[model samples]
Target: MIRVLIADDQSLVRAGFRVLIDSEDDMVVVAEAGDGATAAELTGGTRPDVVLMDIQMPGTDGLEGIRRITADPDLAAVRILILTTFDDDAYAVAGISAGASGFLLKTTAPAQLLHGIRVVAGGEELLAPGLTRRLIARLTTPTPPAVDDTTFADLTAREREVVTLVAEGLSNDEITKRLFISLATAKTHVSRALGKLGARDRAQLVTLAYRHGLVRPD
Candidate 1:
């Protein structure tokens, strides 16, 4: 089962998420916290696979909690999915930079939210395509005149292609169809690229791709 921890200041929000998450056959809400500090504490105790974190908690906030959790080597397997009402593009960028696996609006559909939890638990970043572009654009400054070719030197041509597509916000299945490759091949390429690049997750890969000029703002 995919264990989840809900961290939101509002009790009603936490209860609602618990109900929805508990309804899933493959998932469960192992614990809930009303603040970032407590959320961090419960995470260690519950060892949840995914954390549904709200950005604006009473104290310690979601960003700080994410930083704390991601920094712990013992919690390396934990994936944080930031769910909040705030649409400030900067939050999305900050969340990713702090090692969040995904960021979703609280207004997102229930079905999509569930899917996002699964996606992050399966070790993939879950930013929507449009959001991905906006977030990356906000975080990426213009590349220097002298580009660092060696940044991606380790990736093969096909691996580089896969990374670029991922930076473009294509899922593995989408990449398979677009590139006329098998699903397994696409997944393998992505996995290999992540390993070679030493990317903590796809969010970091997206940052690298943009910073290295693999993908440009549109």
Candidate 2:
């Protein structure tokens, strides 16, 4: 079963999410926290496979909680999914930069939310193409400048292509199909890119791509 932790300031929201997640045969709610600090503490204790975090919380906040959990090598396997009421892309970007595996609005359908949790737990990011474009648009105000190849001087041509696809929200499988490369090759490329870029995961890869203007709103 996929173990999950719910971190939200609202007791009702936490209760509702608990019930929904518990109903899933593949997942179970392992713990709950009302703030980021407690979330980090509970996370260290529970070590759930996935954390459904709220970006806005009373004290400490979910962004800080994500940073704390991700910084700990012991909790490196723990994946965080940002579940919030806010529909703003800036908050989503912040959460992604802090190490969240995905971001979804609270109004997301129950089925989609459950699927997103599964995706994150399975080590896949949950950004759709439209959401990806919107996120880029939110960052590049007037226009995203041309990509700087010098910014990626360390990446080989193949690695650059792989990282670009990743920032475009493509999965390893999708990238393999798109580039006509083997699945293992795709995975290796992504791994190498992460190491070379010092990225935590695909989420941070997207953030770095944004910084260097490698991926634009499309």
Tell me the spans in candidate 2 whose CA falls farther than 4 Å from its real position.
128-131
The number of the candidate with the highest TM-score is 1
Please name the candidate that would achieve the greatest lDDT relative to the true structure.
2
TM-score per prediction, in order, is 0.91, 0.90
Task: List, residue by residue over 67-160, the lDDT tens digit for candidate 1.
Answer: 8888888997899999855465677688888888888888898999999999999888888655766776676676522345799899999999
Ten-residue stretch with the least lDDT total in model 1: 139-148
Q: Which TM-score value belongs to model 2? A: 0.90
* Clash totals for all candidate models: 0, 0
> What does candidate 1 score on TM?
0.91
lDDT of 2 at 13: 86
